[model samples]
Target: MKVSTIEPAQPLDHLAPAGRIGVVALATDFNIEQDLRRMLPGDTQIFTSRVRNYNPLTIENLRSMAPGISAAADTILPGTQLDAIIYGCTSGTVAIGSERIAELIHQSCPGVPVTNPVTAAVAAFRQLGARRISILTPYTEQVNCEVAELFQRHGFEVLNIAGFGFEDDTAMTFISPVDIVNAAKNVCDAQADLLFVSCTALRASVVLDEIEAQLGKPVVSSNQALTWHSLQLLGYPAPVSGYGSLLQQLPV
Candidate 1:
């Protein structure tokens, strides 16, 4: 028998040389991971961990996820570098508050840029110069009101907000793209400068452009905004097109 050690033929490049992103998704969410991965650059790497969440979606249920936030963030590439960390919940972000979410994530990832759907949506709207926005969600009126208030606090006019009155997160993922488009079109205010489809559970990314072309206004979805903002934070140069104007309009 013989044993030998030899030098490698070539030096190895860094893992995820293009970029690496961390996603803290909800235990009940079924759409955010795939939607975000599909929209991110081909060379970019995605790492995801799920936080515990209560169903029958309500403000109380959403806020219940707060305790698991730091644990979920810590599991994703611990002691390593991630360009950004995304807490992939729109209502949950509103429920727990974005500042607190960032603080929780930073408890583990310390200084890594943290983003959520609501924060990402605000940045998307600001980048597109949209002050008047109409919203579509899969939550009940109570959750919808909180989302509206969050945006209002950011100084954007909430033209209108409509919801599917869904209580289960799994059911929200099953919402058909056609139905989402129809609801978005109907819910959007005539005077709105943009339409925001709010929910990580809703599969809205595939139809963002379709709705935009029909309504002649920019469309931003939860997963779309999160991925777009992560890419921007990473300073990835390539433009991600076909989803919506929010992704394509990356700053130079």
Candidate 2:
């Protein structure tokens, strides 16, 4: 598993030469487009679809809207030439369950590869050889507990779990990168093999390097893990840096 760092590359000189990625977002308030613009290669084109007012940070909301969100994603992604499509909601993926969501995306896009953030996180944990995980999020207690249960059901041990008790998914984007690092440190423990900062709205990538150094362990965030996984599925090696050990160490 050789990891590559994200460095300055040649900018896209042609408008239509690069591949396109479609992301179907569950929440209207997330700033994923802005953050991904900074992280992804300049050659890639990103397209987004937003589900109106849907929030996965709450268990009741997540449970109520999983099907609708998946259906919305399916409906919004057709007729586009997407190399891949990613479901941008981590908890939504978990709430609906990965296999079902993957099935829906495949049914919608036919041959195109489909991915979700939660599936990516699980893959990242496995690739990092992490068995005991410390989970952190900007979700309510119910959502956080559900996330822990989801992980445990998937065979990973949740050594610890904590969250910021935020019910507003969109408001999570305002949490600064420094605060994200601090929150991770607050919930992380020596018993855990990895720290999972679970939220796409938070600017986890901006502080991944610092957090990994402080914890001396791999730190994975929803967006970072999904980005890494999405690239891998697109047949590109993980070649990004300034994040953390997961991105630094390529998945096997």
Candidate 3:
């Protein structure tokens, strides 16, 4: 073998990836993983970290998941750089606060962009030109009220909010799509320009297209918007169809 000491005329072409995004998913979450897989481009890679979560999905229980987030994120391809990290629970993000979650995740992975369902939902609503949004949730009234207030605080008009009246976090995942669609119809209003399905555990994307077609407006869901916004933060906001209108219309 002959070895050349001189430098090559052209440096080797660098290999770049589409992007790498992270999700700090709850241990009990059953849908976020699949939903993200369906929406993200084939070139993009996802890394997950499942944090501990308790039943009832109370403010207290939701907040308790925060401590495990940093450690969970640390496990996703250790020593590898990430483009963005998403705290994947919608209500949990509200209970814990997006800024605070971002602050906590950044404690271990500094300077990386962080987002949650709440922040991403708001951004999705904006991108879809929806100011008056009808909110549908699988939570009880209390959590719905808190989330309504949270959305209003961020300047979205909550035309109506209807919950399935469930408090069990794991059970929310079991609620049939038929029941969710019914609850959405109950909350759907003429004054509302958009419909929002909250909760990462609830299977909203299964009926996302049907709901949007029936209501003649856009429908944004927890996992759907989370993946879209996470991709947006990584500068890959191209149109993705069949999941929802948010991803199909939003541009980078």
Candidate 4:
């Protein structure tokens, strides 16, 4: 009997085709992954990273937690084969400093582009021609102050900032989308060209479209901006609709 020989598959061929992005999220979060999948295009995949929680979401805790988060990214990335990675926390990135967080992730995964939500938010603001931004957050006063300083250092004007003063990060995730939209309407200034609903935990994405329509300006949330930026970094110009003006109309 003659037997046909089967050819062995190449190592790279066995792996699934790499998408444009990889997102590393906090461990104790809400359904950020599910939300991302629902919001992003089918071609993009988000990878979550495990990191320890240092409560209060303060700057000191963020600084203390950077190594663990970076290490988590390093551990999860090699197997996934992603084009770019996003550190998926707005407050975490702001507290740690966007440049510092990006550098750390880059050091861990060389040649892999790293972006943070804070940096992405700033970039989105610039891209959308926003000069004055109204900020909303679910952080304590201290953390909010740090974010304001970080944005100021990056050269964007902060017209107003409001925080819900919630100390727990997980609890922030339960905030209603309608509440976020109402807060934006109340805090946003007519002079401000953009509204920034800051916090990965907050459910800002659900109400982004409504807020933008009501205010007649671009509305950006932590996860939305990061996802868009991550996709852009991966060289995928995914046209996202029904989210906000930033996603629907802004150029990648």
Candidate 5:
């Protein structure tokens, strides 16, 4: 037997040389990661960890996932630095509270900026000077009410809110983008400044521009807003177009 050994290649630059973003997604979610990957810059990297989620997609079920947030966050590149971490849930953030979620994530990834869909959506709305907004969701009326109230508390007048009455997180991902556009148009108020489509499990990113073109108003979705806000925290200033108006606004 003969053995040959070659010298190892020189250490290469970090794989995520541009930026590293971590996501703590719901175990049942099938859309957020995919949407984020498609939206972010090619040089940037995405790392994800999933937290166990309860079924039926109720507030209680959503809140059940809260305890494991820190553990899920720690699993995403432990002992390494991340430009930002995203808690990829919309209704879950409303159920558990965005501030509390950020605190839990900080327990593991201390000093790292943490954001969730709800918070990011609010920021996107404010940045676009949208004081009156309408909403569309895949959740039942109960969850829809909470989402509307959360936005109202943030000082934005809720022009209208509508939903598809879905309860399964996984099923929500299968919602057709065309249906989302139609529902958004139906729910959006003519007088409102913007429309927000809530739900991380819904595939809203790919059709945002088309919706905007048809509605003649800006549209913000859970996955799109979260990606935009994460890029903002990472200091990525590129004006990303084709997704929607929010991404092209050039975060400061």
Candidate 6:
């Protein structure tokens, strides 16, 4: 079996993608790429690496997974130069702290923009002018409390939060968009300016607009927020639409 080599004869200028993004995901996750890639334009390319994780996501498990993320970030396609690297987990980011996660990512992909759901969610809420938000997650209540606390510490008011009481990432991936839509409705807070569905594994991207239409509020899911944040850091000019209003109305 033979693999093709890079065509040296191809145009040296702009021959590759306009931007490259590296996403470090959980070992059990299965949907980050399917959702993020469709939101971006064809000019970009995606690279992903999965860190170790397990089911029954206790606080101890979440905290223990933090140390291996930087090593996983190092596995991205070498020589391509990532524009941004995102640690793609909601609950894990809460446990590790976004600042610490950024520090870890920059250690490997220095000078590149670093972000995660926690960081991206904060930025997305700011861009949407949403100070008060309702969050829906597929995590156990134990994990949800920390996630709520994380949002509060970031200065957003968590008007309400609802979780599916799930701990397994693989099971979270199997959660249907309809179930997510229903959960969004159940957790809808009339006082909230926006709704946030938290979980890269939840496949909420496909149903974001529908949930928005039903709730009459913009919805920001884990993958959508991360995709928009990545594009913003990359300084991509084109708007990433159809995912939701968050991507369409970014600040520059």
Model 2 stretches astray by more than 4 angstroms: 1-18, 74-78, 250-252
Greater lDDT among 3 and 6 belongs to 6
TM-score: model 3 vs. ground truth: 0.91
If ranked by lDDT, best first, what sequence of candidates would result?
5, 1, 6, 3, 4, 2
Over 4 Å off, model 4 = 1-20, 77-80, 249-251
TM-score of each: 0.96, 0.86, 0.91, 0.89, 0.96, 0.93
Against the true structure, what is every candidate's RMSD?
1.3, 8.9, 4.2, 3.2, 1.4, 2.9
Model 1 CA lDDT for position 170? 84
- Candidate 5: segments with Cα more than 4 A from true spot: 1-11
User: Which lDDT tens digits does candidate 2 get at residues 38-84?
Assistant: 66666776677766445445655666665555556666546766787
**For residues 1-252, could you state the per-residue lDDT of candidate 6 as single tens digits?**
998887688667663366888989898888988888888788887888999986788778888988898899999987668888989988888888888998888878888889899888898899888999999999888888888988998898999888999878789999888999998998989999999999899899888888989999999999999988888988877776678888887546
Cα misplacement distance, residue 27 of candidate 5 (Å) = 0.3
lDDT of each: 0.91, 0.77, 0.86, 0.79, 0.92, 0.87
Q: Per-residue error at 72 for model 6, in Å?
A: 0.8
lDDT of 5 by residue, 125-211 (tens): 989999999999999999999999999999999988999999999999999998998898789999999999999899999999999
Predicted candidate 1 versus true structure: per-residue lDDT over 119-221, tens digit per residue: 8888889999999999999999999999999999999999899999999998899999999999988999999999999999999999999999999989999
lDDT (10s digit) by residue, model 4, range 1-252: 998998778554433243646667777678567667777777666767767767777778777878786687777657556688878788888767777877777776777888878888988998898888889998888888888888988898998899989887789898887888788999998899888999888888888888888998889988888777766776665578877877764346
TM-score of 1: 0.96
lDDT by residue for model 3 (1-252), tens: 997798789978533277888889989888888878877888787889899988887788888888888888888777889889888899899899988898889888998999899999999988888889889998888888899999999998898898888888778889999987777777889899899999998888888888887888888999899878877887874777887788886566
Worst 10 residues of 3 by lDDT: 11-20
Please provide the root mean square deviation of candidate 5 (C-alpha atoms, Å).
Answer: 1.4
Candidate 2 least-lDDT 10 residues: 11-20
Candidate achieving higher TM-score, 4 or 6: 6
Clashing pairs in 5: none
lDDT, model 5, position 16 = 70
